[model samples]
Target: MPKIIYVDPDGTRHVVDAPDGTSLMQAAVANGVEGVLGECGGSAMCATCHVYVDPADGGRLPELGADEDEMLDSTASPRTTASRLSCQLTASEDLDGLVVRLPEEQI
Candidate 1:
């Protein structure tokens, strides 16, 4: 399992063990982590699962896909280079200890 660290807007941290192949959004939603709504149920159509990958770990994440790139523009929060849809990020050994910061809002 990969350990994912989700940091809420107010700085609360929720650590979760995500099984291999599970989306980060799924892991967060399942573990009751605040700030990740996953409203689209792991689909890249919605930006509700937006998160900011820790810059230090950015290189470890998979490349951004077309669907996620398009939806990111619709996020309620401003997007940055580190912005990513958690639903598009799959858990794997390479992503162990991945840390992501939640935006102020996910609507």
Candidate 2:
């Protein structure tokens, strides 16, 4: 299993073990990580799983697909070049120590 380090707006961190092939949103939801809402159950329909991929590790992540790109545009928060929807991030060995920061609000 890979490990995910989720950082909240308050700078609190929660490290959770993410099973391979599952989406990051699923890992966060299963672990009850406070900042990730995962309201659409990993579907690209909702932007509730919005996250900011740490710049240091951004290049390691897969590129965002069209659906994820579109959904991110719907977020009320300002989007950055590192913006990503957790539902689109699949857990893998390459992402073993991936870290993502949650937006202050997800609605």
Candidate 3:
């Protein structure tokens, strides 16, 4: 299992063990973490699951796919270098302890 630390907009932290091979969004949704609507499930069509990855783990994640890259451009919040769609980030042993900061909004 991968340990994911989700930081909410209000600075609340929710730590949960995510099953390897599932997406970060799936783990968050399963845990009922607020702010991650994940309307498109694990697809890259929605920006509802956008999250800002901790800079420390930034290099460990895979680069965004073309579809996800385009969708992220339409996010309500400003996209940073570390911005990513949680649904696009599949959990793995290598992603253990991944920390993601939730955006101010998920629309």
Candidate 4:
């Protein structure tokens, strides 16, 4: 299992075990991490699972897809180059120890 670190807006950290092939949003929601709503149930339709990937680990993520790219524009927080829909990020060996910062608001 890969490990993901979710950092809340207040800087609190929640580390959770992410099974291979599971979306980051799923892992966060299953583990009760704050600040990640995952309201769309891992679908890219909702931006509620938005998170800012740690720049240091940015290279390990998959390229942004069209649907996710468009939805990011609708995030409650300002979008950054690091912004990504956690629903689109799957856990894998390459993503072990990945860290993402949750936005202040999801709605």
Candidate 2: tens digits of C-alpha lDDT, residues 4-72:
999999899999999999999999999998678888788899898899998889878888898999998
Best by lDDT: 4
Which tens-of-lDDT digit does each residue in 39-67 have in candidate 4? 88977988999999978788899999999
In model 4, the worst 10-residue window by lDDT is: 34-43
The runs of at least 3 residues in candidate 3 whose Cα sits more than 4 Å from the true structure, single-residue gaps closed, are none
**TM-score attained by model 3:** 0.95
User: Which TM-score value belongs to model 4?
Assistant: 0.96
Which residue segments of model 2 deviate by more than 4 Å? none
* TM-score of each model, in listed order: 0.96, 0.95, 0.95, 0.96
Please give the distance, in angstroms, between residue 17's alpha carbon in candidate 2 and its true position after superposition: 0.3
Tens digits of lDDT, candidate 3, 62-104: 9778998999998878999889999999899899888899999
List candidate 4 stretches off by more than 4 Å: none
Q: Write the per-residue lDDT of candidate 1 for residues 49-104, one digit (tens) a residue.
A: 99999777888988888889999999999999989999999999999998899999
Ranking under lDDT, best-scoring first? Answer: 4, 1, 3, 2
Q: List the residue pairs that clash in candidate 2.
A: none
